[model samples]
Target: MSARLATGALVNALVRRAGSAGGFATVLAKGDATAGAVLIVAQDRGENPRLLERGIGPTGDVELIAVGPDGDAQAIADYWSRRRRNDPDLWVVELDIAQAERFAAETMLGD
Candidate 1:
């Protein structure tokens, strides 16, 4: 199996990449550095928000899966709050930018 990057490192890289691309990225909740799962809350300048997480796609390759509420901040917050309660080791990140989904997919799958 191919090696995976540490969760902390991946988060750092993603934050930097997003900032460099004129976007805003921040870690909402930090998780285990080595093996935690990551959840991305992506938006276009704070609009059209989507919550994404890496999961096995139909072809068995890793892909970003939409797993939470979109377009409503309160709903998204509630969803993630419930998720964090269940999985304390899940990392939550929010990225606001144009094409936020693309940025998230690239940062996550590229590794």
Candidate 2:
């Protein structure tokens, strides 16, 4: 499947997972080359610092996940690992919900 389709599927799955826990997840693809913060939320001082050390900064209602040719599943795993440490109470996944929705639609249509 195309990367976009795969990403969409991943997102859709994550959204469902988030929904089960009363949280929400969304996907935002950058049409331009502009890079900026994706999420900004308060974290305790004892929280996991890997994200900060990796330049992730913080987590907000929206968190940024990298998607592209250079992006791989390992990147997603690393992101989640850091996120879990930073917020043990929250659940984070690497799938892209928007992409996942599209994937689901296509799959339903048997495309």
Candidate 3:
């Protein structure tokens, strides 16, 4: 299995990458330093909010699971808030970028 990144390192890297690309990112809630699950909120061009999580595809490649749009921002936030309650070790990383899918395709790592 591929090595997983520490939560802090992962957050730092993501923030740096996003800034360099002219997009902005920030952590909504911090989680365990060593083994937190990353739940990304990909916001594209001020519309179409999506919930993203990393997972392995059938082909063994790293895949970003996009949980389609959950209508408005408030609705998605509420959805995630409920989820966060269940998994306290979840990291909420929001990305405001032009193309969220491209960001996922570029960053997610897999074996």
Candidate 4:
């Protein structure tokens, strides 16, 4: 599958995982013909955040990642690194659907 498709699939998996956390997951997707796309997930304090990582905000935290038909892994990493450097706490996760599935399964194990 194409990178865009892969990314989209990963984002969908994340949304699903988030939703399973008792309505504590929120996703924001935006795109333009030229600008490409991005997926953002806000996960509130719940088993989900604890599953992913503890110490996240109770109100939730933002997970931003680029999506769609442009940019390679390095580009995506650099883009976020350059712009989001001010927010040093940002976590960068690169995954496909299979990886996401494994992540979900592992997280469900409660570390």
* Best-matching candidate per TM-score: 1
- Structural similarity to truth (TM-score) of each candidate: 0.96, 0.27, 0.86, 0.28
Q: Scored by CA lDDT, what does every candidate get?
A: 0.91, 0.34, 0.78, 0.36
Off by over 4 Å in 3: none
Candidate number of the best lDDT:
1
lDDT per residue for candidate 2 within 1-111, as digits (tens), equals 432324335445545765564444443231112222222121123232111111232453222333222234455456655654664433332223333333323322232
For candidate 1, which ten residues in a row score worst on lDDT? 102-111
List, residue by residue over 15-86, the lDDT tens digit for candidate 4. Answer: 576456443333322223222333232223321211132232445643322232233444444554553455
Count of steric clashes across candidates, in order: 0, 7, 0, 0
Model 2 Cα shift for residue 41 (angstroms) = 19
**Candidate rank order under lDDT:** 1, 3, 4, 2
- Regarding lDDT, does 1 or 2 come out ahead? 1
| lDDT value, candidate 3, whole model | 0.78
Candidate 3, residues 27-103: lDDT per residue as tens digits?
A: 98877778787788888766778888877777887687776355479877887788789989888888889887677
Model 1: CA > 4 A from native: none
Candidate 4 TM-score over all chains jointly: 0.28
Error of 4 at 63 (Å): 11
* Number of the candidate with higher TM-score, 1 or 4: 1
On a 0 to 1 TM-score scale, where does candidate 2 land against the true structure? 0.27
Error of 1 at 58 (Å): 1.5
